[model samples]
Target: MNEKNTLLPRQLGDTHIRLLRIYKVVIESGGFAASEIELNISRPAISAAISELESLLKMKLCHRGRSGFAITDQGEKVYQSTLQLLGNLENFRSEMNAINTDLVGELNIGITDNLVTNEQQRLTRSLSTLKLRAPEVVINIRMISPNAIEAAVLDGQLHFGVVPELRSLSGLTYSSLYQERSQLYCSEEHPLFDKNNEAISDSTLCEYDAVIPNYPQPIKIKHQQKKLKSTATSTDREGLAFLILTGRFLGFLPVHFAQQWVAQNRLCSIDSHNRYFDTHFFTITRKGARENLILEAYLEELEKTL
Candidate 1:
């Protein structure tokens, strides 16, 4: 019997790290062609890299025969270790590079309609500053809802989110950018405008037709009012603005969006008392990544525009 070859501990080399990355791609994809697609390398190159990795480890890292390619039990352990090593390596590089001014990654921002209506000026000003400070960094904006923004950011689909601070998110870092209030609005002819009797109860307001946005916060508050039987309406705030401008119906709107209209007499607040909805609008980012300089700078500029 051949004597078992003895192995000595050795430092992992750059070649080993590269091959580990290729191996990860192959295992994640299960096919050489798929790995090629993911790694942006040729299929032959992927196969060759896996062969090199197996030789370096002196063990079968992949069971890449007949039925679709699969990794062995040992391969699974290796893959886990590779992931940890790569993750740590990346964190190290990020920490080192983050000290300098070379901002080179894409920043994905999630924006909701309410943000568009209330904080558009502030956001645009922030972007303008970013463009001058970090021209290399790309910005991708996704328009989504205040309710869904939290999950999307947590899941890494978005780098950050901006929305009305209806409340705090348990796990997120929220920075209040500006204070905003929601204004109750109606056509000039709405009877809630009797103007003589000031305060009306929920039951009294329900006697007339009302339109509402289909968002969790609004829906929750509306449902809590036991006496109101509102004909629930679902539309983006832009559509809501259009409806209000046309004298069709009434609803609560971000004060900024309706301010000009109210000044021009196109829309009127339900009560002269200005029964406004008070909430802080905020910018949210994951706690860990907020330390990234590019993100921090962007947020700093955002605070200035508030």
Candidate 2:
């Protein structure tokens, strides 16, 4: 090993973190090919990240060739060290999140439906980081309506509730987190799917059947919902999506949530540029509640993710 490679740099930076993360994923995934999907990178990129990590550490972390994929003894040790490092970093975050807060207890979080397609995946990723910080902590997640989540948080049934910023309730603190936009969509079998957006006037849109939400909606969302004839109604996004996919009705869905169908050409936006609404999302907690170390720790991890 070169003398320069024998010692770590004086200060570890983002580059080091990136390399270690790649290495950790590779090890956990068992091979480069297996890690490609999880890492969202190509085999070549995975190979390059591994090579870079090896060069930085001056050691062959794993054996990769036609023969087989296997982790070197040193690689196993480094992986363990990586876990320790992440845990330590989370410890600092938990402490900074609240004064004298212990990383113990449960975190009951409420979240709205159909946010999995979000590109950032900030919520799930932050929860993972929090789990690393407190392996023993019990984290419970509830998927329910925004209003239901609000009531739960206000009533102390939930420590954290994430909902769109339709309206804020008193006696609860809110933190801005995410913003999502929903556009009117129709499946390819619909009459308007092949038509140009410019050709689709409000009158033309109103001529077709549309699905409206049975749940409550904000003023802006309601205005958009009213643009089309309400021939159908759904209690949730999945039902609305089903109705839209049937090509008998048009409905509004989050862009990210509808991407898969759009990619398949089974769904397309209708006057998306004109008929869309953006929803700002927030995390809510009891405003004057007693201190909770678990919630504070999670918020800290989540803030870093944001």
Collision pairs in model 1: none
Task: TM-score for candidate 1, please give it.
Answer: 0.60
RMSD per candidate (Å) reads: 10.8, 15.1
For candidate 2, list the clashing residue pairs, or say none.
none
| Candidate number of the best TM-score | 2
Off by over 4 Å in 1: 1-100, 116-121, 189-204, 218-228, 246-248
The C-alpha stretches of model 2 lying farther than 4 A from their native spots are 1-102, 196-199
The 10 consecutive residues of candidate 2 with the worst lDDT sum are 89-98
State the lDDT of candidate 1 residue by residue for 80-117, as single tens digits.
Answer: 88877875664554465477668876677888775655
> lDDT scores for all predictions?
0.69, 0.82
What's model 2's overall lDDT? 0.82
